[model samples]
Structure formats: C-alpha cells, structure tokens
Target: MSLRRLLLVAIALTFSFLSSFVLATPLHIIAAENFYADVAKQVGGEYVSVSSILSNPDDNPHLFEASPTIAKSIAQAKIAIYSGIGYDSWMSKLLAGHSHLTIIDVASLIGRQDGDNPHIWYDPHTMLTFALAIKQQLIRLDPAHQASYQHNWQQFVASMHPILTDIDSLRQRYAGTEVTATEPVFGYMFAELGFKVRNLGFQMAVMNDTEPSISQMKGLHNDLIEHKVAFLLYNLQVSDPMTEQLKTLAQTHKVAIVGATETMPKGIHYQQWLKQELDAVQKVLKK
Candidate 1:
C-alpha cells in the first residue's frame, strides 16, 4: 500500500479504538446513603461506577453537612441518588444548578411526602421499588446494557426473598409488640413488623438533633416507668443524654434494648448487616 493509504488506515483504527473506549467508560453515579450505594452497584453492575457521599459507618447521615468536594461530585455525576424526604436537604441545594444530571430522589419515587420517614431501605417492599427504579434509570442511560441491568436486578430480587420472609416471620412473631426509640430511624421497619412505636416524640427530637422538650422527656420517662414499651431502640452514632437516661431506665425496668446502625460496618456485606440487626431485635423481643 502507498504511504498515504497506510497513514489513513492507521488513523481509522485509532479513531475506532477511541470510540470503543468512550462507549465502555462506566456511567458515573453518586449515592447518598451506603445502603443505596450497595443497591446501585447491584443494579448498575459493571456498566456504572458509584460513590457514596456518606460512607463512614460511624457518621450519622442526618447530621452530615455538605462540603465543596461533595458539591463537585454532585455536579459531575450523571445520576445522583438521594434518600430525600427531608433527610438530605443539602442534596437538593447542591443539585439546584446541575440541570443535565438525572436525579433519582428515592423518596419521591417511593411516594413519601414531607415528614415521612426517610429510612426506606428497611422496608423490603420499598427496597424492591428502589431497585426497579434504579434499573430503569440505568437502562435509560446505557441502553446497550439494559439486558445486564435487568438480569442483575432479577437476581437481586430473588436474593432478597429470604429477607422478606424473615420480615414476615418477625411480624407474625412480634405483632403488637410495643417499642420505643431515641429517633425514628427504625420506626418504618418496626411498623412493617407490626410493632407499635411508643416514643415517637423522643425519637423525632433526636432525629432533628435538638433537645427534647421537658414535656416530651417526661412523657418518655412515664412510658418507661409504666412499662408501656417492650424495648428501647437506639442509634449507635448519636449521643443523646435522653437516650442514655432511657437506657438506664430500660435496664431498671427490664425493657430490652436494641442498637441500630445506619451504615454497614467495614467487612460486613449488606445482607449480613441486616441479618445481624434483625437477630438482635429477635433476641430482644423474644425475651
């Protein structure tokens, strides 16, 4: 071949390689919670790469303040997933100028209005919805990988069957069981399992990071003394004097105590962390 013809062929091959590289690059995603990060990974599979802003297992997601770094992440991400429901209001503020990115507000997709509990992951049904929504969004971004995303989601749904079964069993075993928490972190899960939450005021106080009113504290004390609650659930991350007082009262009144964490600790997978939490609840409630 002539030198000119050889140069043209080489250029064509280089352009083809560059096109393949561009097409194969993973879709960038930013997830608000660690739990959603796991779900995003499963649903997106190899076609998407995810970064969770609140990754520290010890950090209370409610108390997280957004920084410039997080803002940059949000600006560059093609898809952003947030728990919403007023839980991560900072996310909305950060996303205001980014009109090109597709935002998946989990709360909106799940039909939660303002003041609704944002811990949707604890509800298996809600999680199923989240997974489906994620799969659909990912397919829209990369149609070539639709089959892979759907397949992975189907497997995820199947894998979660046991968790759903366990939830049902818990509901059957602990129906009408009275529980109290420092915050509403686990209220949705408790409600799903048929447990009556008796300390909503106290939990809401802690969730909002404010001192409970004297009346609210007095009411919680009364519930403890009157044996109105069967168990006390506390978030491990937040340090609340009221929760500490309640812990002491729980021990004195023989009320079971269960600690719940928002993040899955290092070295523990999503399923294992959830199973551990459910086991703690089962053991405490069974007593």
Candidate 2:
C-alpha cells in the first residue's frame, strides 16, 4: 500500500474508535446561575453538558424575566440547577412543567429557606456540599463514568483548600472588623470572614428593588464618610441611582472598595475566582 493510503486508513480507524467510545451524547444540564454551571462542569467533566441562563455578570439577577425560549431550554434539559428561596424565582416558574427533569435547588440543599440570604454559593461549605451532590448526580446519570466523576470530585475538593485557608487567615486577622456595602451580594463571604456588616435596612431595600428610607441612606453615608467599616463591598452586578451614589461616596471618602459580582464571570474556573476575590479582600484590608 502507498504511504499516504496507509496514513489515511490509520486515521479513519482512530476516528471510528473515538466515536464509539462516546456513542452516548453528554447529559444536558441547565443551570439558573453561572456559578452552579461552573461547578457542574468541574464535577461532571465531559459526561454532562451545562448551560447557564444567568451567565451575564453585569445584569442584576433579581430583574431577570423568563422567556418562552428559556422555557423550551428548561424543558429539553435532563437536569436543571438553580438557587431557590426567592433568589432565582423565575427559574422555578419556568421549570414548573418539567417534572421529570432532575432538579437541584442549591439553597434548599444546605437547609436555606425562604427569607434567608439567597447567595449561598459565597460560602465555601455550600459549594463543597453542592460539589458532592452534583458528583453523586453525575454518577447516577452515567454510571459508566463513575470512576472519572469520583476522581474529578476529589480534585475539586482538594482545590478548595486554598480558598478555605485564605478565609481562615482573614478571619483570624480581621475578625469583628466592621464593613458595609451597597448590597449584600457578598454577605455570606463577609460573615465567613467574621465581619460586622452594617446597613441591613439599606441592603434589604436594594435587594427587594425598593427605595431605601432616608434614614437607611444616611446611615450608610455616615459609615462611608466616617470609615466605620474596614471596607465597602460594591455590588457591580446591580446598580441604581442610590447604589451608584453610595459607590461614589465610598470613592470620595477613600474607603477601601471591594467589588463583587452576583454570578461567576466568564473565562474563570470556580476555585480560582473565589480565591482571587478573597485575595482582593486581604489586599484592601492590609492597607
């Protein structure tokens, strides 16, 4: 046989073998938030396909409105993951028709109920719980790849050590340090760091899409101007005139500003993203 013909036959055989190996298409997963999708990708590896509806980091998830297209996507998915307890309420409404689909409500997984803080992913323990749960789900969905899923889950758990260590170091060095924010997007992380977060009324008002009372606004202003807190967490995902004003005041007063987002941003893994944010906190507080 000619040399070129032999090479072509070898390539054809290799392609056929690879095709048979993954004869089953990946399990389709739809996540209401991007962070969950990121974690799903880590645990499921190539066995599951994940799509996130709330992938945009700049938009406020609170204002998300579901479309017929979104409903169709949810209907076609084999699994749907979302943050329950009023965080991604629109996802619940859209998923009502998909009773057969395996659903993972992350908030409820950790015993969070309605009226509790919905940003549960900010807590390291919450993500760990979610990683294990998703790993189990992947194993059940594709038992053929159980070993691969287990190995990936173990790697993910190990990668979390740096994040936990950073949090612990910050907690030890800065416990009871006061802080404030335009919104409570990072409330769980702040609590993990042992911060006394001020301006609850204002934060709740913003989260609920209501105007903050004059008193609430004044209190946050004082916190910024007087440097009552070690830093101010600026929610870059959501913005209104009031929140914008607080950000400006924080800048004017020279209070340390740490910006946080609601969803995981593009082109970053879950573990690295969390570590970078924690590092930002350490850097600002060390000043």
Candidate 3:
C-alpha cells in the first residue's frame, strides 16, 4: 500500500478502536449507603459500575470512618451519592477535594436540614428524586447512553407506583394508628402512613446518641405497656442496653416490632427493601 494510504487507514482503525472502548466503559458510581447505590444501579442499569461504602446492616452509619481506600474510590468515581444532614457527614469531608465528581446529596436534594431525620431512603419520594438526579447526571456524563438512562429512570419511577399505592392504601386503612420507634430511622415512612408516632424525645435522643429524658423514657414504657402504640419500628442496625430494654418491653406488651436499617441489606434491591418494610408494617396493622 502507498505510505499515505497506509497512514490514513491506521489512523482510522485507531479512532474506531478508541471510540468502541470509550462507549463500552461504564460510569463509576459511589454511594455512601447501599440503598443509594441500589437506586443508582437501577437507574443506570448496565451503563454504570456502582460501589457502596456502607453495605452491612449491622454497622452504624453515624460512626462511619472514611479510610484511604474509600477516599480513593470517591476520587475515582464519576458520580457520588450520600445522605447529607449529618447522616454521612464524613463523606462530605472526603468529597471536598474531589470537586470534579458529581456529588448528589440526598438531604440537600430533598431540602432536609441538619436536625431532620436523615434516613431519606425510607421515603419513596426521596428515592424518586435521587433516581431522577442520577438519570440527569448519567445523561450528562455519558450522552451516548442518554436514551438508556431515560428508559431506566422511567422504569424505576414506574416500579415505585405499587409502593406508593400500597402506602396510600395503608394510610387509608390505618390512618391515625399509633406507632413508635426506638430511633427515627423510619419516621418519614411512619408519618407517610399516617401513624401517630409517640415518644419523639426518645427517638431523637437515641438517634443523636444522647440519653433520653426521664419523662421520655417513662412515656415510651407507658405507651408500650398500655398498648398505646400498635408497633415499634426499631433500628436493628444499632442497639444499646437501653434500646434492648425497649424491645423487651414491646415484646412483653405484644407491641409488634419491625426492624429497620440505615443501609440496604445484602441480596435486596432498593424497591424490594422498601416493600418488605411496608409489608411488615401492614402485617402488624392487620394483626
């Protein structure tokens, strides 16, 4: 072949190979909690490679310590997600130097403040919001897969319809039903279902790692013993002697208990996790 023709052919082949490789590369996503990771996966589908920092159900998110490995992952990620408002504050510090990353703070997206309950995943709407944000960011990051991202977002939104319907159905059927929690982990869901949550002081204290006031403790005990609360949504991820005592009191009074978690448990999708918890609540109400 002529030298000029050979050079042109080689350049064309090189460009083609580079284009294919770039197209096949998935967007790297890092979520502080598994639930957010799960949502990003659902929304990004095969176009993303997701990693979750907090995947264990037993770990306390409040006590999360960021390591060099985690910092490296954050630095490498094209997209990052975390619940702000003090839930995963460490993530913010780690993310500070990674200004190039597209950080999605769920608390900030949902306008939740510092004192607000940070378990934003329990609220279906929060996931919906995050899913949309993920979709937008993915589209921006990989415009070639814009259609795929949109389709995934639509499917995710469609999937939540049943959960929303279930919430409405439960609210209509059991609105004003009394419920309590060891912590406010599932408070948003409880409120959405129209359950009258008692012992706010107690829940806040436990969530903040402070001791509940004597009156708050007395109120929680009385509510369980008197059957004033129909169920106790306990934070199974964390437990001290005090929370364990409350659990015993609930069991003694026959108050149904549903365990809630800060992170999405292993072997479950985000939608499944929410549905399972809602189903648990419904079962308690049925009983």
Candidate 4:
C-alpha cells in the first residue's frame, strides 16, 4: 500500500473508535432531594449526570414548588429518585408520562408506607439500600458499566461503616434515653440509636405545619421545661413561633437543642452530612 493511503486508513479507524466512545453518553439522573442526588452520583460516578431538585438548606422543603426547568429535567432524565410516601409528591407529578424512566422511591423501596416519617434517609440502612438500588438500576440501564457501578456501590456502602459504629456506640449508652424533636426530621436516626422519642404528636403537627392542639403544645412545653427529655431536636430549615417557644424552653431548662436540616448542605456529601449530625448527638449526650 502507498504510505499516504496507509496513514489515511489508520486515521479513519481512530475516528470510528472515538465516535463509539462518545455514543456512550452519561445517563441523566434527577433526585427530588439533594442527599439522594449525592448518593446517585456516588454510585453512578462518571456514568451519570445528577440533579437535585430541592438543594437549599435554608428553604423549607414543605413549601417547595417545582419550576418549569425542574419539570423539564425530570421528564428527560433516565432515572428519577424521590422520597415517596409523600415527602416530595411534586416529583411524582412531574415524573408522570415518562414511562421509560427508572423510578426509585426510597420509602417504598424499604417497605415504608404513607404516615411513616418522610425522612427515612436519616437511617443508614435506608441510604445503603438506596445505594444498592441505584447500582442495580444503573447495571440494568447500562450493562457495559456494570463492573464500575458495582465497585462504586461497594465503596459507598463501606464508607458508612464509621457512621454505623457511631450508631452502635450511641445505642449502647443512650438506648431508651428520652429525647424530643421539633419535627420528625431526625426520627429515623433517633430510632436507630434506640432513644425513646417524646411528644411525637407535637412533632407530626409541626412537620405538617398544622396547629398542634394546645395540649400537644403544653405536653412538649412541659417536657422541655421539666427537663423530661435529654435533648430537643429541632429542624434547622423549618421553624415557627411554636418551634421557637419550645427551643427557648429547652435552653432555659438546660436540655440541649440539636438542630437538624432537611437537606444536605452544599459541598458536603451524604456521608459527611450524617457524620456531622451523629457527632452533634454524641456531643449532646456527653454533656
């Protein structure tokens, strides 16, 4: 073959290989909440592009309304994740008509039903299960990347070991200990630590943004004022007059107040977020 012809043939083969690599585009993944988006990213790695619909730590997630841009994103995504059981119902509405997308409802994935706390991600198991689910879904969606997904998922699961150890240590020392929260945002974590959560009715009412019966208010107030609970868990993203009143009482009575946010803060991944919260718990308990 002539030298020029041989060089041209080699160039054509290289172009074909490059075109094939470009064809394996990253999957578009949308998560209703930021933490789930972080998990999807951890498991999906370079194979996926993830978006979090509700990512602000200061915004009250209960009052969130979907924007047109968010809706369009969900419609075009290859996988959509939401905390089902009513946490982000707007996601369910936005996800409709896209039957081709894979949906991961963390609540239903773990057998939780409506009326259960929507913040199931607070439990380590919930996130681990979610990571595994994302891995499987990605494997099915792109079998070519199955090994990558499996390795990433394993690392994600292993990263939670320290958090699990913290949970066990807390449970050993504070199991059956009395605690209270302004809402149920950290209820699952409390359960994992085996604490007896007090004034749950008050919490549910606050979470739903409804009036907790005067008696419910009085019950929580009395718990705080009387120091019946070891610490008060308040939602940092959400606070009302009622929440403030209880927070004041907690402080005055010397009961520690632990603030928990509804969404993961920016620049911090899910694992770091959980570790910080667990550290706060340990701090309050040791006080």
Candidate 5:
C-alpha cells in the first residue's frame, strides 16, 4: 500500500477509537420490576441510571396500573427491561407511542411457553441469561463501556455460582418435599428445588386473579390437616381472606409457614432478599 493510504487508514482507526472513548454516557434504563433494576445495575455498574416502575413491595404485581408519570419515564428511557408474560402489558402500550427505545422483554428473550410461569426471576439460571442479555444491550447502547459491562457481568455470574450451589444442595435435601402455597410467586423456585406442590390448581387460580372453588379450598384444608404438606408458603402482599384462613389452619396443624415476597422491600438488596428467602425455606423445611 502507498504511504498516504496506510497513514489515512491508521488515522481513521485512531479516530474511531477516540470517538468511542469520548462518547461514554450514563445509560438511562427503565426496569419494570425492582429485581430487574437490581440486576441491570449490577451488570451496568456506574455506567447506568436505572428506574423501576413497580417498586412497592406491598402492591400486587399482577394487577398493577401504569400511571402517566410511568409513561413519561418510559418515553425518556433509552432502554427498558420488562417482564412480558402479560404481567407488564402496559409497557407495550407505552412503547407503541415511542418506538425508538430498545426494550428488552425478558419473557420473549427467554422463550415464554404456555403454562410457563411468569416469575422468571426466581429461577437462578434464568437470571444468568438475563445478566448476559443486559450486558449485550448495555454494550450495544454504550460500546465504549463494552469491556466494563462484560467484566461486571462476569463477576455477577461468578458470584451467583455459590447461590446456584446452595439451590442444588437445597433441592437434594428437600426432594419430594410437599408444600402448599397460597400464591404462585415461588412456584418456579420451589419446583427447581424438587419440591412437590400440593395445591397447584389453587395457586394457579390465585395467580390468574380467579377465585378458587369451595371444593379446592376444602381439599387444601384437608391436605394441611392430613399433614400432607411440609410448608405453607404465602405472599407477603395482598390480604386474601382464604390465605389468612389457611394461615390459621397451618398454625393449628403444625405446618411451617413461609412468607415470600414478589418485590424486594425497602432497605434490602437483591442478594440479601434472596438469602432471606432461601433461609426461610430452609428453616420451614427443617421443622
């Protein structure tokens, strides 16, 4: 090649590198749930500015109403992390008006199947997939931080290895252990741990916002009375009269009660929240 041509190519490469280095900006990310917000923050590190729409732990995620302020947040967001499974369908309405933003639908990326539980975050393996997807999206939005994003993701995954190991250990220890849950929030996690679910129909009815029949409730009560269940997992949010009644029954019948939360409460991080959940399960199962 001619000297002038070689010099021009070198200059172009140098300018390209310099542009990427100078264009680094904090990523504006809007996450549907607090869990995704935490995961995105961990992966994006200091290069991201995150906001979550449904952050209240006391609210029912299944029946959340999106406000105008949330719509504006979505409009301003450069990237959005949403849980698709008909849980956050409002995001679709918001995205329809503003189509330029890159929205990452966790359900679509992970392949949502019929009868597939929407609580994907409870599954540790799915969280790893989410981390990789978040890393890729952040890298795409801010190529200059690609190396940093990758490094953060690697560290996050490495940190999750111990959690995965704990999950496996719990699975072996609690295999075939039967549990009854009022809400289906922990269905995926319990299933992963090889625990037998006693009231699947009841849980599904509650999850879909339908009322369970008297016979189903009676059967559940009988199961508790018969000592067929080892634990009674209940949602910390929502005051279901039936669930409250069942809680009393569980107390009377000596069935251990385990409270699970769909959203992390204030002042607790992701790791701490998950550790508390697992510890609750361990304590319930041991008794």
Candidate 6:
C-alpha cells in the first residue's frame, strides 16, 4: 500500500477504537443512600459508576448538609436515585439546575406520600421495587447491557428469598410482640415481621427532632417499666442524650434493645446488611 493509504488506514482504526471506548464508558449514577447505591451497583454491574452521598454509617443522615462537592456530583450524574419522602430533601435543592439527570425518587415510585415512614429501605418490598426501577433506568441508559441488568436484578430477588423466609420465621415466633422505638427507623421492618409498634407519638417526635408530649413520654416510660414492650428499637445513627437515657431505662428494665442505622455500613452488601439487622432482631426475640 502507498504511504498515504497506510496513514488513512491508521486514522480509521484509531477512530474505530475511540468509538468503542466511548460506547464502553461507564454510566455515572448518584444515590442519596448507600443502600440505593449498592442496589445501583448490583443492577448496573460493570457498566456503571455509582456515588452515594448519605452513605457514612457513622454520621446522622438527618443532619446531612449540602455541599458544593455533592452539588457538583448531582450536576454531572447521568442518573440520581433518592428516597424522596422528605428523607433527602437536600437532593432536590441540589438537583434544581440539573434537569438532565434521570431522577429516580423511590418514594414517588411507591406512591409514598409525605408523612409516611421515611425509612422505605427497611421495607423489603420497597427494595425489590427499587431494584426493578433501577434496572429499568439502567436499561434506558445502556440498552446494550439490558440482559446483564435483568440478570442482576433477578439475582437480587433470589437473594431476598432467604430474608423473606427469616421474616416468616420471626413472624411465626414473635408476631404481635410489642416494640417501641426512639424513632421509626425500623418501623416498616417491624411491621413486616408482624411486631406491633407502641408509642408512635414518641417515635415521631424523636424523628422530627421535637419534644414528645408529657403524656407521650409518660406512656413510654410506663410501658418500659411495666414490660408492656418486648423490645426497644433504637436509632443508632441519631441517638442523643435523650435517646441514651431511654436506652438506659430499657436496659435497666431488662427489655431487649436492637439498634437500627440509616445507612449501609462499609463493605457490606445490601442483602447482608438487612440480614444482619433481622438476625439481631431474632436474637433479641430469642432472649
């Protein structure tokens, strides 16, 4: 071949390789919660890069303040997932100028209106629905990997089978067992396991960062002292002096206490995180 033809051939090959690289670039995703980020990772597999803002298991997610770094992340994300029942309201503010992002508000997907429990991930059903929605969004972004996304979602569903079994077992053994919470962090899961939650007014008060009514406080105290509640579901992420006092009271009264967190801990998959929590509840029940 002539020198000119050889150069043209080299250019064509380079262009072809660049096209493939562009096609293979990972989809950028941002989830407000770490669990959602984990779900996105499971569904997206090798085809995505996910960022979670409220993922530090150590910090109180309710006190999460917005920053320029997080805002920039949302601005550049191709897809953004958030629990939108006022859980991560900061995300909405950050996304105001980021209209290009495909937003998956999990609360809206479940028709969970305001005033509903914000801890939607605690509900197994909600997570399943979230996985499906995430897979659909991944397909929209990367149709070439649709099969992979579908397969991963199916695997996620399969993994839940065991957790569902655990839930059933707990329901049989501890259903109708009364529980109280510092906040409603584990309310949905408790309901799923057929445990009755008492002192909702106090839980809601704690969640809202407000003082519970004198009557509500007295009711909780009396319930704990009288052993009306079998367990105390404590919000480990947002505990304060008041919550600590309540926990001490419960401990003194010999009530089992199970701690719940707002975010997925480091290096644990979503299914494992949930199973560990359920296991804790089971242990408490056995005690």
Give the candidate number with the greatest lDDT. Answer: 4
lDDT of 2 by residue, 46-150 (tens): 888889898888767888887788788787688899988998889878888688789999998999999887889999899999999999988887899999999
CA lDDT scores, all candidates in order = 0.83, 0.88, 0.89, 0.90, 0.85, 0.89
TM-score versus the correct structure, for each prediction: 0.89, 0.90, 0.92, 0.91, 0.89, 0.92
129-167: candidate 3 lDDT, tens digit per residue: 999999999998899899999999999999999999999
What order do you get sorting by lDDT, best first? 4, 6, 3, 2, 5, 1
Alpha-carbon shift of residue 98 in model 2 (angstroms): 1.5
- 193: Cα error in model 2, Å: 0.4
Which scores higher on lDDT, 2 or 3? 3
> Which 10 successive residues of model 5 have the least lDDT summed?
19-28
Residue 209, candidate 2: C-alpha displacement in angstroms: 1.0
lDDT of 6: 0.89
lDDT (10s digit) by residue, model 6, range 1-287? 99999999999999999999887778999998899999889888898999999877877877788779888778768999999989889888888878799999999998999999898999989999999999998898789889999999899999999999999999998899998988888988989999899999998988888999999999999999999998888877775898899999999999888897778889999899899999998888887
Cα RMSD (angstroms) for every candidate in the order listed = 3.0, 5.0, 3.5, 4.0, 7.9, 2.9
Model 1 stretches astray by more than 4 angstroms: 1-20
Per residue, candidate 5 scores C-alpha lDDT tens digits across 1-287 of 99999999999999999999656656789998998898899999999989998899877888888898988878778888888888878778777867778889998888885477788788877788888999998898789889999999999998887777878999988889988889788988887899989888888888888898888888799989999998899988868787899899999988888998988787776766777898889987776
Q: In candidate 2, which residue pairs clash? A: none
On lDDT, who's better, 4 or 5? 4
Pairs that collide in candidate 5 are none
